[model samples]
Target chain A: MSENTTASTSPGVPVEDPTPFGWLTTADHKRTGRLFIISSLAFLIMGVVLDLLVRLDLTSATKFVSLDADSFAQSFALSRETLVLLFLIPAFLGLAMYLVPLQIGASNLAFPRAATASFWIWKISAVVLIGAYLGNGGPYGGWANGVDLHLLALSGLVIALLLGAVTVATTVMTLRSPGLYMDKTPPFTWSALVTASMLVVSLPVLLGQIAILYIDHRYGRVFLLGNYGIWERIDWIHRTPQLFIYVVPVLGVAAEIVLAAAKRRVFEPLAMYFTIGLVGLFGFGAWTNFAITGEGADIIDGLEGVVLVALYAGALIATAGLLGLLGLAVIQNRKLPKISTSLLAAFAAGKLVLTGALVGLVGAAADWLEIAGRGNDGNPQLRMTTWVTGQQSVLIYGAGLLGLLAAIHWWAPKIWGRQLNELLGLLNFLVIGAGALLAFVGPALSGLLTEQPDFVYADPNATSLYSNWVDDTGAEGLSALGVAGTALLLAGAALLILNLFISICLKKGTEATEDPWSAQSPEWLLPSPPPIGETDELPMLTSGTPLLDAQEENEEANT
Target chain B: MSDITPTLASGRPQRPRTQLVATGFASAVCAMMMAGALGFYMARRHASGPHPGSDWLDGLAVPNPQFDYALLTLVASLVTAHWALWASRRRDTAHAWTAIATTIVLGLGFINMVMYSMNRMGLEIGSGEYQNLAFATTGLALAIVVLGLLYIGLMGLRSLGGSVGQRGSTSLGAAVFFWDFAALVWAVTWYTVYVVK
Candidate 1:
């Protein structure tokens, strides 16, 4: 038997043998999870800095910082890549890596060595990718381009993602504790399973595309002009379909947080699961929607048309089903607790997901209208504009980031054995929410007027009869709004980080109880910062709300 | 707080068998998905336009016969590697050792044949699109095969030290599974690139 010590008082102190070199070789999921969180946060900061630079450059028509075209493209590409690949997705996966075992009452991940290797591989690949930026002006091939160093960096990132997918998937599949059946698994773990499964299926296409791109770049430019449609097809599949992979797990987070906050069992657990499964299915099934944009609609005919329509219909139905599930959950809550930052953040995420879905419907409608020859000639370009960027921002950054924030807040007690400052948490949530709204909405509004983002620079000497709506006053104002929103977003991120540092490192917050939030999940039945050993036994789960059920039994015994 | 001695019941410790099976399953799934991606790409390319003709494949500078032989050697390696695993599971030490050695030799032969084929082709990666696909598919398979060989070789050394036996059979089994997967991937690549056209 190990002695119990208040982890909050001695945060970061290893409960087990504190060997000096243990950090290097530790396969402890908790420690690995922390490493992932800290590293991904660092990448997030770097990405935010690059984003601010891009926003600053977009502030005026003339280059604010005067970067060369290649440099500008590289910075933009790197920023988007870093945020998506290195930050958002990894951060969610890291949280899952840490929390899933606990939620399922497992001692450790399924493949601890593989989990460790995955972390190191991801970290090393991120370093290599950033290093590639220093070589050859840092991948000027735009976000999805197949240029030389960029292709290499993309491949490295893809390999890292695949490793992570394998580790997380295998862990969720194989490491559940006794009596925790698949149907009774916590929402977050369920989401992680779906996300990992999707990654296994979808990411290989990305890897294959990049492999082809690398080869084309190495040999002759076979794909440079002649085979560009092929590249575009693959890239679209890789990019758009994979967005759900990032968003879906966060949706699970939102569901968990909401259920925890409302202190109620989910309205229809099976229905929710079914909807989530559909989300994953349609996520990949909708690949053709992206593939058939622009000239592809005309080029692809016959059987492809039938496939595209079926996919489109599937995506629409899945989106509707998910929305209905969310709405039902919200309406069926037994009692709402006082608003916490975590709850607010979860709500914000849910709203953002809904907004993204609505925007997607509009985009789909535009595509359909264009295909029907009932819209303007440039409808395809319009559909491909910053409107798409806005939709992504709503889903990935707004929904994804906020949902993660909600999880961090909801699980911080379990993670660090202390509470983040409530005042700071609320402030951060409000600021980030406002920032997300401003940032995404501005671009969406601008996209309504222009066929492409205004950030793309044209030579000053070139004159055309067509008006450049992107550089006009309206677009400029929107760009400025986006920059302002980014500033607020950075401030919120800083505040959240500071709050976490103070709570955990400085030990200023009150010590967390086992069930700090009165949560219903099984993890809350364990000690805060669960004991680090092979003998730590979790109470057998008898229901989805195992902890609540146990508490009810104890109350009955007392009565 | 009460002086409660925390009875740390570290949730279920994973069985070695579970780890082996889990890892093997993951590897098989990943390899199959990779093969599927390759097939999807090939199908799309074929559907896009007229076949570029046999001249296109020949122009890419891939020595089809040598590549085919290398794939055969890879398949042989897989067979011997799995045979070693089977023997180790049954505690047939001498037979397992002999089979592993044969597997290593065949793996080396495969690598040599691939190198010779590439040399005969006398083409850089940048020669053409077909060359690009051919190299990427073959190169990826080759890398996986080499990694499997290295792992199996290390296991062989461990066996010599008398540390690996029934207790370490799971490790040997996983290695066999991985090598078998690599071989299957090679077969896919061979058929897709060398034989399909």
Candidate 2:
């Protein structure tokens, strides 16, 4: 247990170098992790700002940012900022691949060289993607463009993936003390493993396809074009299996976070086995829908692709079972000895459940619409589905915004080592969530109306986007509620930015020396500023709570 | 601290053989599905009298001059393996260093052939149906080749520590023999298919 054992920065090693160039080139995980978190926050703010502008524009067709039919078309077009942000999320996700291992008690990643390569690849790809935005072709077209970048950017991603996958697998295999076996690993680490496996299996196929596309773009070759057509090219290998590639690990991360924050374990270990099984099976199944129905195919066929639709339905049902465990957790939180910080996390987990359930409900409804042959032309279910899918301005701007807010708050401490003021934190949540929820309500209800009402003729300007609700209320109470909600949401969103900036500036310096939550994981076993190499002696663990265990060990040694 | 002998380095943990087997089977199945696609490509080329090379496979096309290259690559692989064994037996640093470098070069050259062969086939991204499949399969092949490169690098690192002493060196030699044997079998299969047919 001597501090001089290993995994320590040489005492002579400076924490942060004085020279600007040296500072910039340092690959020290702590420094990189900080940069990653800060960059992610910047992206978050940019996304939220653009979203609010788009929402306000939607609320009134002739608002300051006009939304005429042609304008709508232009709005949907990929622009410079849009492309940058689009690439940024995965870049941050890649960054997580670097930072998370260090946070989880490993010295260096499993493959240091590959880890370095992954970062360069992502950074270079970002430059290329952003450069393409300024180019005349408008950065390829549609999701295909995303794939195009995937091809150019894949070598780095593969490098990152290998390093990441090895780090996770090795941590599971070798890094842990003899006592911390498969069953006893912390929830977050468990999630990391699942995410790692998905990386190994899923991303490779996607990268392969993208690499093919990149070659086609560079040369005159037509991998997905010509007599056979692009969809057929995809359908041949993974007609329906591709969706799980993106979603399986997302669900894994979500499940683990929800359980840990909620202070609950998964209802059954076997449940995860089912979850991964279904993910792999349905991942293949989900992609097939795209094949039969075709990508960007009609809403009806998208709704109807039975096998894909059914798999999604089954997934939703299983997720609901998982959510039920979470719900029980919220109730259980009432009994647990709740510290202020843990309470903040617990509250965020509570909102996560509600948001997740709504997402599932929206998806199920979309599936039912396809099954019933009712689509956006007349059916509400179909309209809702179309809205919630990534394309809809409302769903993307709304649901994703809220999810980002929740995730930011949950990870805020680990990222920065400081807590937001409790009051401001609550205020931040209310404003962000309420803004997105109101936007969702206004657009969704406006969408349901289908035809412009006679009342619009009476007073066209008065009949805003939520005119139906106003008309339903006979021009009085509900319209007032809608307006009030809109005002609250918008003002709240603006306040959120101000609040975060202040929080960042005012953050307590000394707290940076403490692991924020008294984290029960290996991450907190080291000093607040972890040593460059890592801790000297591997921290011992009796239960799953290594940090807590370390504290007791220190006390015993002193006694 | 006393000449700080490295802590008894952890043994290579056993993988759930079941998971490994499952992934291996899945990978094998996928590879076959792709190989079956080669038949369609060959058939189309036969019927049409000429076929455009796939974009992904363009990287794999070894030039005619490189015919001897594969053989030389195999010899280097064997020499490196033999050197590793010799070094381990003699406890010689030079033997370890030589073996590690040669093996890496051989692995890189082999990987380059895979790239050249695929690129030559024009199995570029977005190439129509058959070509896309070819690109994906070729990419998988490159990934495997990359793993071999990684193995050689790991061996080099372990060798420096003298941990990859005689036993490790012998195992690596055995591995090289197996790889060369496989390469011969592949050469035989290629001649049987293209020349005989």
Candidate 3:
């Protein structure tokens, strides 16, 4: 295909200006995508700083940062809120917005205006939530239960999440290249679609909870004050179903990276898609398991015990099946060259997800035994303490963040026309991986040792079973480990940033080629940082790996 | 240079259908929100016994005639909105414009009737949890209907200006879909809050 013929300007006539004003108003997917990523990164840095502060507080029994009990609670709450809501989700969203159109050969997002609106709304919500922290020490009700309590800042954050979800979902459903059918779409794009769908289903319930609470806070008590069941239900909806939401996209990211690294098509593309679909179905069904016992027993008593067990089993099985298929695909391919950073990170993410699933299964079994009256009553608290926190760390931070890092490394060239330093990429992975293990494991072990649940222990310095555990049983050592892990994680994050800055701003690297990784997707067919509004440059795809087909055609012609 | 028209332009034929699907999805989201609000209201209602506001439940207990009239108005507005969308698709510009104008008026009337009814009942949102639920459910439905009216009104203006016609009916169709969804939600809200004891 002739370059000139394929490189047409974006629809509705291209704007001429290239100033800041132009960028602010530009509906171009490339620019919008970058804005989402950069803003999310800024949020990520803030979240990491807050996380380090929380770890610092946990290092010793006494107040570490001159913070009171409420202030300490606020710190951890804000860190989680920032990381989960403002950082990780939006970072993936930015990647999807920027890359999905290019991957599918679409010139722009389906609703560019809506995409712009969504990003700004999210940014504003983050600011509002952070401002709430500055104003009144923020909503101390923990990130999962925060919005359900009806704080102004938390309400704004939920609304922002809702808008963002709608915008991303609409884009995936409506925008694709002319010939790119649903099954033929790239794995990352499919993951995005799944993530968006989950957001649509789950976020609204949270929004509703927030709305009701907001009305109560502003006007009167619509919901009963301190109703544990209501809070549990709301938290269950936001937290449990969301585990799959975070990991599904990462699975997609890892799949793409593994395929690229292995230099082979997915061994069973149809099975892979089927597994993804099953994962989504099971993800939705598993929300009941989170709230089925403990505080939620009263509210969810009507639900059959067998159904809850089935849901948990199904979610775990589906997740395992997905990971197994991906691993098999990678193992069967023999075209592997040197292992790239993307591949290593992808491999690590898969391991983390599998670990999370296995941990979840064990937790489920423990809960089953407790319900069956065969285990100690304290098992529920143990499940809440170590089991829940460990699973979240393994799934969200370990798997989700690693998957995103892989995407960042894999697509850096296509995103900014520059390559990340491979050594630094690997270093970032190792340091963060170690940090993640220590930070998560320390808490999990400490949680098991403690008699009380995680949330009940507001002040670690207080004279309680938790504090005794901290004082006696290696908990202090574990806290120190957590602090060390956090430091290393921060260092890893800084190195990743440094590498990008060196490559892009310092111009320390050579420009990337059109197909730096010999990738099979259509996106690799375009130049690194593919021309804006020129997505038509790619040839129409007849298969999932269009670039591979094109390479084969060229090879045949040359021979 | 080879003469190749970009697929982006060629893909225009599929845009309307995709947009329609998006509109449908958005409507589903709205329905979900309505369900969530309703669920919250029911939970609150059941969690606690009758408060001071339960006294006013007498109005809903007897099937007030005013509520029946308001529901009729809402149903009429939905019909006219769909009529306008159907007319627009057939390029019946005059009929479309008239039907859309009537729909907007009916929507405004419904909002007014809700406010009037709330006033007549002397129900303060702060009176009790039940009153609060009533206010929130009705207020949410009202806000959605107002949005629907604004959208349909804009389409009506566009039709009159000849900016929209048979070729540009997707926007009108989407607006109609939202209006119909709002009406359905209001029906559920009304029954749950006013009729269901």
Candidate 4:
């Protein structure tokens, strides 16, 4: 654990300086991962900006900014789609692309070419998706061909994501360092494995959902009902337990911060593993589709309703387990861990995930209760309200982003060869933290306080999008929070974009000293800004914390 | 400190069957997609009742010989797919080429029969719920078949490029895995769409 072991920024070593064109065709995991990260972040900017617009529309409770209800709904749907697929999934996948191979001590992904293809496919499809939305053709879009294009693009995104998941999972399964058993992997890699496997099994169902919608819409719209019907079919992907898939990596990222930033391992690694795996299990949402009996009609019965209840309960239990693990870290450490920006992000992430799960459980149970003939009696009824959307946003936008920001800041040296400006990092975290709270939670509470539906709607009688609910007895306080939250989120995202530019492009700060944090993972062994073919060689690994073992042995030799 | 870069390094012990392992994952994804589509088909069929009159085919003739031929062609292709892998393992280039060629032909044959059956039935994709499911399921199966065929072609080239000795042809093995999965999908689809009905 000595600080003096820092490797100098030697002159002879080849730093990672791949040209721009090389990145387009390269199969190197590091380059591929960087592409996923940077592109996903760009999309994050767009996604949040679009979300802010949606929030404005909701705040005024009408099509105030986006022109018409169809346009507003389309933006709303596309923004949600972009947040999960383009922003959240790839951000972490990008992290995994960079870290998993390094963590597992693999030369490259299992299928390097496939990994390359996955990134490009996602990038192309995302662009096409944006085009489709702009063309007035998405789920609630007015144009027929545009809608078809959107569906096609969405399907391609799903395919790309699934392919990438396969590569990551296969790499972990077959290419781990000797003796680094699946159960013994580092927390972040473990999370990637679980998330990838979950996506592999679950995402294809979404593809199926989109395919049916595509054919139904493209060929004959008679059977598939209308826009609402199409949206409902894909609704389950964004709902509770199902949406928890995106949060699985957050727990992994947080746990890694605890060990690295805390400079100590957890008291019990297995419990943390169970926590990550459980969240992933909860996220297997292929079965949650709302497409059946053709339209608004659903057919939830004894076993199905019971299963939904169990899944929501499972998410709550997993979040609690995560909290307990973090508490264990605090109790085990001799002194409080350093208050780094990454750790702060980790704490915020835990809080957001907890709130998301709690709200999600309420909304899910309320929905299940109604479906199971128990009751729709949760004050204003949260089942089909903005509460559900708010719960997802908390996890996907709030916690998911924070956890990844924590990872990016913690591993900036490895990924970018420099540390992010700490002042900017902390401010970015604060803005995003506060923004997510007001933006998502505010609307979520509206579900209970007011009679709002899940998304923007065009009321026939009322001038605004919302109907009689706009006149409901309450201060417009919650809607104001939504607007404020969006503003904060957009600003927060911009702040991140700025931090990345200053830290990466401007080459802020000196080259990172090896083991700058004195972290004890195998990856920290490689030169900061690792070289072409990783380490020339590594000693056989018999434990999860090989670097820690190496440190102990080095001290013994000195003594 | 003690050249403590003795920590850890990546790159497993020269993994020999990376292709086979990757193919298994890809096959699982393809299988799951089919399973999901089938779920929709089952639900719609259940709602329409066990016995929808003859018009369930969208006022067209029942797909008999063509559907039957498509199933038979896929069933026969599995053997050739296996043969290709077996031949590649033994370094029997002639047999490997023959087996791969035969499987490819069988795959093309299945696609041709499927198209002819749809054409004969004149099944309009937008006509009804069942027709929609039919087109969706059939199109999915066709995509799988085409993908498997391309994989076979790629693996065939790889085998030609490398001499498959004792470790066996990893690429060829993976190709067989996907081809088998394609056949399995056709089996399920045939049973669900034609035989059971």
Candidate 5:
């Protein structure tokens, strides 16, 4: 409960007495960090399991479960939506929300009790969401009024979000330790603060929309229906504001890694600011693209599409700016040694493989789009073909999957104080990467096959997802590759989970360690097992590495 | 830079005086938040087409009187936050506890009002878009206020008279201006463009 404002610690400062029922009553950031990681991984497992079910249903070309076509459709889409909304986003925030402020010198979150309460709210909401599956007509039906269950789920979601947002906002606004001002704050912290602001502003609007959705479901609320053009409003929420929630946080993490790894500050402050602004603005524009392209009297299908395309172009520019920063860092820091270990496998190998797969698929899609000559007018067949074959499998499964694996490996030591076996980790990365790359090729081949005349004997009643792909030989090959990827992915995922289990089982004597990455930072300078209160001494910052600076100072004093 | 060194020998840093100021500002904000929520609830009750026999020809019906109960709750929350700040500033242990006890009462008032408003609205998410905006934003704003009050209350437990509640109140007060202004602008524009138009 004591205030610890200084960044430095006094030597051998006494650790504060643990609070009564400390572990149970504790709201300490580090404990919260561990909980966040575990909870997110749990959600990830659930999402992956659902994904496996989806893939299995597609692979077998029959309803594995005794559900109608509509039910199947509803289940699949909802599963995809939930995977992102219910699982990934929440889980990612679990760590980021807890860790960012602490890393940036915040004493505690702005509102600690709210932080604890939000966790409960989120858990309850998750339960209600799962419970919605058992009710009247499942949680949602595609393009229909059966949205009440979802609305109910959202009520819980809004409560949770409000709690999470308030806690995070206050932490950012009030809890920063003395000397860490707006500018002096770490880069990661800056990105987090920006993201937190976005969340505070944007989440309420989303909650408002969810409220409307509840009405539409429960009481003939025609907000999104033909009457109010509610769908357009909902789409508005989706395109711009929604993108920031995901992108900004990822940018924050990337910025931290880039700056620390490159040993350089951000290239230009204005560029970072401009990039955040553009993303926020263009994020809104992208929603118009979600509008139905064909003529429904209410649809505003005119220049909105053109505007969306142009906005997407802006997104590319921001991405380029980030890449430019990365490139500049490379050129400037040729002397800094590249550190490698089994942990780097996911970052290095997974990325390389995922990149190669993206290239191949993109090339195939470009070729198909040109051949079909439906360049501006979106050809549904061509679009669906490309989606099922490549982007869906690659981006969703490859980049997302591998990136998470890498993050887990990188953060494990710091969080758990245990090292992953380097050989096993590298093997897991390779298996996952190979599986993803092979999976990408399957789609392009399906597209090529679709163009050929000799394609027949594919099942007629085999649903849009299956029938679309079966028509293309390239798609068929892609599906085959998908089968392999699925096997490999499952094996890899299982192996990773098994490794976690093994680590848990094999605990060593308690000791804390800092700078698990062997990197240079103030955090790393602390004693291996630092005191809980964080000692009252500050390292004199000569170089970026504080431990080295301290060692040098000691040597000079001795001389 | 000279202020970096602590004069207090107790090892606890001094509380920045602005914390008391922030408590004042946050209390006012919370009052507005409660008032807005009450207004929204009333507007909806009025809009639900005149309570049974209580009709007037001009069609300007006042909303649910139950909203007063909610407003009272919000006021209670504000007072608690204010007292926490006041007690901490004066180093008054007894009043700080009293303030905390009052905040809990206010928190209960808040919950009661939310439930009552939900019941009266009958789940149309507050009658219309403007009402909906009013209720949702007010709800979030109230939640923030409640948390702020609770934080101040908690700050009391850590202080045996060394100075725990210092730094960042003025900044927070500054932040509330932007936050409140943004909400007002967003709501006003939304009403003008979509609801009223």
Candidate 6:
């Protein structure tokens, strides 16, 4: 047993880790969620490590590292892939699994055993995916069994994620307390519903693409797609519009954190839901195909193209709307809200999401203009350039990871019944925020200085990701700037891993009081880290802010 | 805080619709996957510039008619699935058993015919774009059908234990929904790849 096992939770109760067998087989949503959270964070370290390698490799134009271009290709592909698939997406999914039911006044997900199965499959498949990379078989590897394993493992991961999404979505749709209809559920729960729905629709498209990639690769017939630019085709999951799905949760999560910190009721909760849903609506990136649409296809030249461009712009507006509403609530607080790391992280998350959206908007508009035959040139050629990487970093690193940090801080007491070291959380946020900006701005500026394609071919002449592009400045400093940004991101990720270790294992921080933040959601009604909240009786919720309503009732009773 | 804790637990649980909702959501996922795959198929076919015929599977023998038979068998399974749902709801235990067994056989028959069609086509994997897609699209459809079969089989076993005798069993409805979804997708695929060539 470790020190965390003997940690204090409630006033007299002790928090203990479940027995090994119990943890593995348990259908308890919270336990399953814990498994997801810990594993994904572990994956986060690997992703950042690979990124550091890529950074070092890219520090110069003519190969900074001794390894071949193929090795760096694998590094580039795995770095982005692991961050999104292995870390951010699963981490947020775990958050939903752990908190959605509790927020909606339920005990477990709609299908508890299936949820357990999903998590295990995800964990095993994640191992296989990483193992595939380790065994010389990721994106640009030799035609080996490891490559097939990567495809099959990816197929399994998609299935697991879809199953998990169904569980969360079903729970939200069916298991909410009787009086709490969809509209009346809390912001986080609503966001989970929207997020799960988006995943259900968008992820299947990826599965569809993967099916072709897998079958082709497995059979050794790359006739349809001979080159191992497989990552280029499927990497749309990390692209502009689709990548926003991961950030949609940030908008919803920020609402919950702001409400609790402000101690003020959201005057327009429905508006909040609409904006959240709108962001999710555009995040349905199943329609955008990088290979076809990015090449100035007919889809971009017509009315469909205009509508799609408008939708990308719409996503940015929704992010702005969400930030404005949240800002007002905070500014209007009766007294100054407690200045905690969680609150600060929430603010920073908003700014990052907005920044990411702005970058995405620029990319979309430029592509639209060029395809519509009204552009001077594809200036700053966002596709296949570091410009796209900049947008991805700001979104995935800034919004997704930072928002997750904020949520963990806000809900740590409720999750583990102990507070994280607040000082460490603040440092984590600042370091990561600075890293996100540098990662975005450096590459973005570099894109303007000269043409540095993010995905470089090993042969260098076998294939070109961008068909129409002329060298702008042809300079050398762009690579170094990108390297600097990558270094900062790696540093920030390392600090996060250490902070989590100390908080979860070593510190055994102060026990969390019930209603730690005067939270309005149903989760706050339970004892901090209660075993299965659905078992607890709760007053019938008439609105999103159930706790606030209950407080008024209590005041009336006392009077 | 102590006084409010009591009222917090006062809310009562409602009838859960999880089973049906989950099945419905799963069905939606299957539908989207098929749609996306078919879209990919069409895009690839068009990209390859082989518009010699309407159906992309132009090289295969038309008189073989194996895909036609496979699609028919899957549609037939949907009817039997609906019958089982109806019987289970009416508490006709014997008809429910018969209907479920018939549905299972049809589901198995559909899978057999699909594999048999693949065999009859004699298309080896890794051959080219057409052959690879032929296996993948059909294989994915077969997997969805197998998933429905498992759900139907599970619900059928529940009927023997009399839990499914309860009126409005969502499990039965869900199984039927999944089967119906499987058949619907197969029909669309049948038209796209097997018909109109």
Q: Top model by lDDT, which number?
A: 4
lDDT of 4 at B135: 85
Q: Which portions of model 5 miss their true places by more than 4 Å? A: A1-24, A59-71, A134-137, A141-149, A181-184, A221-244, A251-302, A335-400, A435-476, A508-512, A527-559, B1-197
Go through the candidates in order and give each one's DockQ.
0.34, 0.13, 0.39, 0.55, 0.08, 0.55
Model 4, A1-559: lDDT tens digits are 1111222323432233245666667667887898899998899888888887777666655446554666677777878888888989999998998888878777678877788899999999998999988887787777789888988998899999998999998998888877789878888899898989888888787776677778989887857664545666776666666678877888888887877765667777888899889878976753644543333223334665566666767877887887787777677776888888899998789778877777766665665545223242332345566777688778877888888888888888888778888999989999988888887867777766675666533332244666555443442577678878878888888898899898778877557866677777767766676654333454455566767777778889999
Question: In model 6, what are the clashing residue pairs, if there are any?
Answer: A107-A534, A537-B8, A537-B9, A538-B8, A538-B9, A539-B8, B55-B197
Q: CAPRI band of model 1?
A: acceptable
| Rank order (by TM-score, best first) | 4, 6, 3, 1, 5, 2
- How would you class the docking of model 3? acceptable
Per-residue alpha-carbon lDDT of candidate 6 for residues B49-160, written as tens digits (9 for 90 to 100): 4665554454665434877777777777788788888888877778888988999998898888877877777767876677787677767777888888998898778655
Residue A38 of model 6 has an lDDT of 82
Interface RMSD (C-alpha) of each candidate?
4.8, 9.2, 4.5, 3.0, 8.8, 2.9
lDDT of 5 by residue, A25-84 (tens): 445555444555566566656655655555444443323433444554445544554555
Off by over 4 Å in 1: A1-21, A59-68, A141-150, A219-238, A285-333, A370-380, A454-473, A531-539, A542-544, A555-559, B1-17, B24-54, B58-65, B151-167
- Comparing 3 and 6 by lDDT, which wins? 6
CA deviation > 4 Å runs, candidate 4:
A1-17, A61-66, A226-228, A289-301, A367-381, A456-463, A468-471, A532-540, A554-559, B5-12, B48-55, B166-168
Alpha-carbon RMSD, each predicted model:
5.0, 9.6, 4.4, 4.2, 9.2, 4.2
- Candidate 1 RMSD to the real structure: 5.0
Clashing pairs in 1: A219-B126, A534-B10, A535-B8, A535-B9, A535-B10, A536-B8, A536-B9, A536-B10, A537-B9
Choose 1 or 6, whichever is better by lDDT: 6
Collision count for each candidate, in order: 9, 48, 0, 3, 23, 7
Q: Could you give candidate 2's per-residue lDDT for residues A1-559 as a string of tens digits?
A: 2111224443533333424453355445544444443554444444444444434444343333434332232232332133223323343344344445544444444433344454455456545644443342222233445445534543443444344454445444445554556666654455455545544554444344444445555445443342113322333222112423333333443444454554444556556545544544443433223332123333434445554456555655554554565556556656653334324433443343334334433444554544324465633343232133222322233333343444444455544554455566566666655554554454434433322121111122232433343223222232233344446645654564555566555653225433554444555445444444333344433345455455566789999
lDDT string, candidate 6, A1-559, tens digits: 1212322233322233456666777667888788888888888878877876776654455544634566777777888888988888788889999989777766578887788899999989988988898887887777468888888888888889889889999999988766788888889889888989998988887787778778887786544444364776677777778888877888778889888888776767778899999999988853555532223322343555566577778888998888888878877886888888888888888788888877777666665544212233433344446677778888888888789889888888888777888888888888887877777776776564455566554353323233333453542465556556666767777777677677766756667876788887878876677653234344455567767777778889999
lDDT of 4 at A542: 56
Return the top candidate by DockQ.
6
**lDDT score of residue A92 within candidate 3:** 84
The residue pairs that clash in candidate 3, if any, are none
